[model samples]
Target chain A: MTREGWTRLGLVAAGIAALEALCRTKVIKPLTLVPPSRMVHDLAGLLIAGDIFDDIGQTAIEVGGAFFLAIVLGVLMGAAIQATPRLRRAVAPVLASWYAVPSFVFYPLLVALFGLSTSPLIAIGVLSATPAMVVATIGGLDRVPRVLLRAARIHRLTAAQTLWLITLPSALPSLFTGLKLSFAYAFIGVIAGEFILSGGGIGYGIAYAYESFETPKMYALMLLVLIVAVGVNGALHAWEGRLLQRRQR
Target chain B: MTRLFDSLAIVAGILLLWTGVFEYAGDSAITGPLQTFRFAANLLGRADFWQHAQATLSAFGYALAISAVAGIALGLILGLHRFSGDVAEPMLASLYTIPKVTLYPLMLLVFGLGVSAKVAFGVIHGMIPVILFTLSAVKNIPQVLLRTAKALHLTPMQTATHLLAPAVLPEIISGLRIGFALTFLGVLIGEMFASQRGLGFLIINGINSHDVKRTTAVILIVITASVAANGALLALDRRAHH
Candidate 1:
């Protein structure tokens, strides 16, 4: 990163170009190995037509909606459980078991319950991410200094003040980590659900392409999804970095 | 007694929700927990479920065999040769970060939606995680361990056997456990996309036919497998600790 970023980028670019060349050489069947150039053409076409962009927008909305739901619900639930020991003892194992259940198992159930609409996709994402958020929130809260807790009690700070001043600030970094992970869960959860339910998604487009024998378009859609994923992941990292900076100062 | 009571209460509460919904709803797919369990029992008794499971499990085995050998070998190369890490780690990470389902079409095109495609898919899913984790494990070994091996006039193979391998065995096992789950997931997705038989196929079949119970059954099987896998992994981790 420090030494000539463009050179490193060019090396990576060249490697991809070489693979593209190998694919286009026709030594292997064109259908079997889509050249990078063809893939780029497909991508450019999709971008121009704007259907792919719409799918990307819908996916982002679902992911963002579910991520928001997980943060709010998970943090509140975590705090409630943490405030009450009996609740923690009663809920932790149950939550842990549910967490271990792959969210895909519920994708069909969600579709059955809510139909093939965005609800099912978003619902699965929420369910998948909430446990991670909840678990991390509790850990984050527990890591807050015991001295601070004692001092807060002694000062008789209001619940609102304690939450904002003591708990939230102390737990900020872990909270961000939890949210980062939740975003990741949301991404996979939405994709898997949409893939199964077969409508209004890049997943649906992918299945459509496969069934319709548009392999090049299928690969292009997947590339677009990957680009979106990397972008989202990078954003999450930057967000986490900001949180870390806040902690440092 | 408290533990049992707590667990029972939780189960009862969950069952209560399912039954309440089942009773109130008009001919919905969400059956009572008891009824679902009964159906699960019936499904379990059927040979078809096991056959589908076997199809999926077999693909997992082939993939595991490929990945374990190749990944560990690659990991060793990168771990022992510092230059490999410098040049290859980012390359590997880039591939690793690529969601890999993107390559599903490529595999299908070449392997034609068969068990071979599924195996290749599984290998792609599992190998990178194993390699990266194993590399870290090897890299984190005490320099003293390697120096001791050298002082004892250990050959490279002998050093790998006694020094590097033993040091990273726990991580290697950790990687394998994750690799197993990933292989299962990959094989399932491959089967789902295009395949003849597997739990994924059954689920897909159920979806296409609008057979909710059959679809839910496949989903349940996947959940059970995941729980069993996680439990087994935890047991392995405990064993390693001991």
Candidate 2:
């Protein structure tokens, strides 16, 4: 690891240690926060007891469905827009300002349309996630080298062959960024939807715990979310780095 | 110009889509675009509606102010220090990706159920983007410029005001635009979950009470306001970049 990495780790450790000390000394108050160690311990107990497995499974399915749909739809939409110059010109400003609107405001409308099932959660997830993928797709497509297209034409390649061999490979990095963003947005959307309105999932569990004054359980759930999010992001970052390195070579 | 016509066309397309959705989904799910606009206009006319809007606006204002000032200050420090910036950047990025909704309970507990909690939530959401943008902007400043400043023996304040501030203005504006949206989002989410006032609360309350028209109208108003604000900022951003 790099020196900066080590420094960051040290800083994190020191911060956690400080929190633990404060909790142990009764300065932070047990009602407000538990020690990090206790939170981890409680999380392990919950996992061993299989108490949250159903919630985890439900969240996973919703997130997976949303992520899959967003990627497929976003890529299609992006490609379609790219193909039509007039449509792209009209749609560009809308897409640019899309995120400015708080999309969560539409969750109730979705719930009313789809009923209070995982469908609303998944729909919201797709709504939030798809735009990132679409933006990335457009960016990637825009950056594809004209020289590569020229080479493909000189080789008498079919249109599909040019797209497959030249366009796709050239656009892979940006598409991967889209994938990462889509996952993050999907995860956030589904969890937030569940948190605000739904009757099930990890988000609901945390809200329940909080409302019932189960501080330890709430913290445990929070810790689980943090770990999963950070772990997935780190994996993607490492994979992207390797992929880019190989491309450079 | 063609651009104005294209924009008008897009608006027409959106209204058509909304009408189509209303026709398919029926009255229970959504309002017709025309009805929604009429309802929204009525809402704008009501003094009580402005109270909720004011509540939201005030919280948003505080959050944006705190986020911009703190983010720029912290970003400047980190950007000037290469190792610290390297250490902090990834951590901040990871935090950005995480589901921060999970921390709402903690914010509520710490700040209690009020505007302070809302402001705190907004700051957390909005500040990071500003910090990241400002950091990169500062880091990307020409080394020659810094060397030139050093050669001239300009005071620190003079160097910052005359050199660093102008150089980073465009990127900072871009960041502020993003921060504005996010802080607005954060404030609304905060209202939706805990508060008794604000347009977010009104939307949620309307849904709970089965007032679909009110909910739809409020959403339409909020979306229109945010998009218009973003459009204005975007224009400024483009001008700054040029």
Candidate 3:
């Protein structure tokens, strides 16, 4: 890692530490918000005593499968529409309308269709992920220079080869962007799924903690989720950075 | 022309599937769109619909007011102060990345089941984007404009009114538009997760009671409100650009 990266991270850590100390000292009290120190240990207890790993693990499975499905479908659909000019014009407007539909409104419909379990989570994830995936894939395909497609055609590359070598490679960056966004949405979708229907996901844990008035535990669980999110976001950033570096080489 | 047909084809295909599935499931609650639209219009004719809308819009008003005032103040503060901005910007950005909908429970506890909680939740969620956008806008304010104001010996307050306000007004307006959409999303989501009465409550009650038709109606109402809000904001944004 660069010195700059380490320094920026240190600054962030310092800021969090200062906030934690303020909370501990009663400077930020009457608020009684849990400091990061208490939060970290309490969060550790939640994982140790609580079935958080199982809940989070279950959520990951549903979201993973659903998001994967969306990417596969979205890329194929996006590419198909792109290849056929008539289809592209038809699909874009419809997709845009779907995009504007407040995603939360789908929960009732999903609950009716899927009836809890992993089904609802997957349904919600697909609903949320598909639009972003489709949009990004379409945008990526559209962005690839026309000359490149023509070159592939001139080379008489097979359809599969054309896609694998020309289209997919060209669209990789946008695809990565879509994946990052879809992953986040999928997480929300899973949480929403857990909220309704039969529950027992991390979302359910959070909701249960809230209803039972386990404020500290609820606060602790939230702190963990926040950390996990930061970790996941950082992981994606690093992955993308490495890919960009490899591309540069 | 053919593309238009293709669009209709997609809609028809979806409807066909929707009808087939609903029929097999043997439920009239949500039914199909056409049936729901008729019911939706009937819903509109009722005094209850207007009352529900009034409640929702009033909550929205409070949230919007909070978001606007808070967003501008925070945005300007972050924008003008470079060192603080540097120290805090990445952290804020990271926090933004946390899927906030998941934290609805904490917000529920903090704000209670009251409308103010709903408003405050919306404001916090919506404020970040506005802050980032306006901070950039302020940073982009021309050096020449500042110099000109100083040369005129304009007081700090006068300079703010004459120079900064005029310069950043358009960007601020744009931020407000974005803020409105996000605030609506946040408020409505909060209302849905926990609330006594609102469009969200109406939908949840409708669902719990197996009132699919009513749920569908509520969904339609929510969508229409979203569309209208988006349209209004877009128009406002365009007007502000001049």
TM-score of each: 0.84, 0.96, 0.82
Cand. 1 Cα-lDDT: 0.77
Task: Decide which is better by lDDT, 1 or 3.
Answer: 1
DockQ values of all predictions: 0.35, 0.77, 0.34
A48-160: candidate 1 lDDT, tens digit per residue: 99878777777878888998999998999988888888879888765655644656766766666777688888898899789878988988998899999889999999989
Q: Give the top-scoring candidate (lDDT).
A: 2
Q: Which ten residues in a row have the lowest lDDT in candidate 1 chain A?
A: A1-10
* Candidate 1 lDDT, B111-155, residue by residue in tens: 886899889888987898789878878878999998899899999
List model 2 lDDT by residue over A1-249, tens digit each: 989989999999999999999999999988888999999999999999999999999999999999999999999999898878888989999888988988888887788778899999999999999999998999899889999999999999999999998999899899988988898889999999998889899999999998898989999999998898888888988899898898889
- The digit string of per-residue lDDT tens for model 3 on B74-189 reads 88997888666655565565676676866776576567787877787678768887887788788889999999988999999999998999889889987887677777777777
Instruction: Return the lDDT, model 3, position A173.
Output: 89
Among the numbered candidates, top DockQ falls to 2
Residue B127 lDDT (model 1)? 90
How does each model score on lDDT?
0.77, 0.92, 0.76
> Where is model 3 chain A poorest over a 10-residue stretch in terms of lDDT?
A92-101
